[model samples]
Target: MKKILISGMAAFILSLAVPCAVYAEEYMDGRTENGTALSVQAMAVTEDIHRVVDVLKTGRMDEGSAGDASFWQLGAGTFSMSRNIMEAAQAQAPAGARLSSYTQDDLYILAHVICGEAQSYPDDEQLYVGSVVLNRVSHPSFPDSVSAVVFQRGQYACTWDGNYYREPTPQNWANARYLLEHGSVLPGNVVWQSGGRQGSGVYIRTRYHCYCY
Candidate 1:
C-alpha cells in the first residue's frame, strides 16, 4: 500500500510539472512572435518617418510614383505639423521615455504602447481612439506620421486640452518607451470606438460610429 501511494504521488507531481513546462514554452513562443511582428511594423513606420522628415526639410514633396505618395498631401506644412504630432505622441508616453529614434521598430512599438495606455481610458472609448489613431496613420489620406495624426488641429481630446504635449510621468514614459521598442501587434484588424461625435468628430470616420470621451 505504501509503495502504491508513493508512486501515485510521484506521478501526480510529474504530470503537473509537464504541463507547467509546456505552458511556459507556449508563453515564450507567443512573446517571440509578438516581438517579430512589432519589428516588422516598426520598419514600415520608420520609412514613413524618414519620408516625413525629408518633406519637412525640403518644402517640395516627393511623389515617388503613381503608386507612391508623400508623407502628407500638403508639403509646405509638414514640418510644423509633423513636429506637433511627434510632440503629442511623445506626451502620451510616460515621463522618462523620450523618443530616441523614429525607426520601423518604433511604429510597431507605438501601437502596443498606445493600446496599453488606451486601456486606462474608459473601456468604451479605448478601441475608438485607438482605431482612429491607427487608421489615421495607415490611411494614405492622412499624414503618415503618428504625431501628426494625433495632434492635427482638433483630433485628440488630449491634444485639445493641451495634455497631448504635456510631459508624461517618468515611469509611464519609460514603460511606454520599452513597449514601443519591444512590443508587436496581435493578429486582427484594428477596431475603433463608434458612437455619435463627441467633440473631435470631424477627425474620425463616420462608419464606425464611435466616439471618444
Candidate 2:
C-alpha cells in the first residue's frame, strides 16, 4: 500500500488534487488504471444499491448488513487501531479476503458512523473518516465485519456518547454514500481515528478530527 503522512487539512486537499479519474472505479475492483492488480480484500455485494440511496434520503441506520477492522488510523481525534491488530488482519487474508457478505445494511451502518463522527466537517474530511472505516473492514488485524468495528467498545465517541443514535442529515448520508460507492484515492490502509486532540502519526486533521496511520 502507498505510505504517506496525512499531516493536516492542507495535505487532505493535496491528496484530492489527483484527477477524479484516479477514483473512477465502482466498488473496490482491486486494479488501478494502469491495470496493475493489487492484493485487496474481497468487497463483492449483491444488494440493490437503491436501498442504500433510500436510507440516505431518509436518514435511517436500521435498514441494513452489520458489525465491524484492520490497519490503524485516528478519526476526528478519538479512535485508534494498533499495529499489532493490523498485522493480524493481513494474516487472515493471505491472498486477501472477499467482502461478498457486505450488504446495503452494512453500507448504512457505515454511513451512520460517519455522520455521528464527522457530519460537521467538510465533505472531503468526512470522506477520509469513512475511508478509514472501510480500510479496517478489509484489513485482517481487526474484526472482519462492519458492525463489529463500529460497535466495538471505546472506539467511537458517537457509539458511547449517544451521538450514534442521532439521526443523520441528508448531507451526512450523502457523504457516507459517496465514500461507500466511490472508494477514496487516499490510503485505504488507515484504521485508526481520533477526535478533540491530535495524536502521533496523524495523516490529516480537520477542525474537529484527526486521521492517522
Candidate 3:
C-alpha cells in the first residue's frame, strides 16, 4: 500500500511537470526560432472595414450597426475597424514597433511615413486617408466617427475626385495593409508634405525627408 501511494504521487507530479516542461520548451523555442512569420492578409474592403469597426467599438462605441447601413449611419463601425487594424498591427510587431506607442499626433506622423512608402494611389491613398480619417473622427474638430470623416464634403481628396475609394488591387492593397499592420516610426523628428504638389507623392523623412514619385 505504501509503495502504491508513493508511485501514484510520483506519477501525478511527473504528469504535471511534463506539461510545464513542454510549455517552457515551447516558449523557449518560440523565442529562439524567430517568432512565427505572420502571413498577414492584405486589407480587403470588407475585411478592413470590419476590423475598423471592431476597434472603434472597443474604444468608443457601444453597439455597431445592424445591416448594410449608410456610411454615415455606421460611424462607430468605421472607427472600430481602424482601431482593430491598429491593434492587430501592434500585436504582430516586434518590441517597440507598435502603433499604440504613438499618440494621435504620432499616428498623424506615421501616416506620412506610410504614405511615403506607397507605390499606388487611391487604395494606397486610403490607408493614409483611413488613418487620417480616424484621427479626425477621434479628434475634436471632426464628427467623431470614421464614416463621417470620409463622407464629409471636401474632406478627403479621393472622395471629392470620385475615386469610389473601393477595395485596393491585390498587390497595392497588400502593401498598404502591411504598412498599416507593421510599419513603425524610426527615431527622428521630421515633417513631410501630408498633401500638396510634392505632397501629392508619398513622403518619408527618415535619413532625410524624401518622396516616392
Best by lDDT: 2
Off by over 4 Å in 2: 1-101, 196-200
Off by over 4 Å in 3: 1-127, 165-167, 171-194, 197-213
Query: Candidates' lDDT values, in order?
Result: 0.40, 0.51, 0.37
Superposition error at 183 for model 1 (Å): 5.6
Using all chains and alpha carbons, the TM-scores for the candidates as numbered come to: 0.30, 0.50, 0.28
User: Distance from true position, residue 106, model 2, in Å?
Assistant: 1.2
Q: Estimate the TM-score for candidate 3.
A: 0.28
Q: Candidate 3: give its CA RMSD in angstroms.
A: 23.1
Clashes of each: 22, 44, 11
Model 1: how far is 43 from its true place, Å? 41
Q: Report the Cα RMSD per candidate.
A: 24.9, 21.1, 23.1
Please write out the lDDT profile of model 2 over residues 63-133, one tens digit for every residue. 22341011111121111112222333334322412344457877788778888887777777777777777
At residue 152, candidate 3 shows an lDDT of 69
The worst-scoring run of ten residues by lDDT in candidate 3 lies at 184-193
If both were scored by TM-score, which would come out higher, candidate 1 or candidate 2? 2
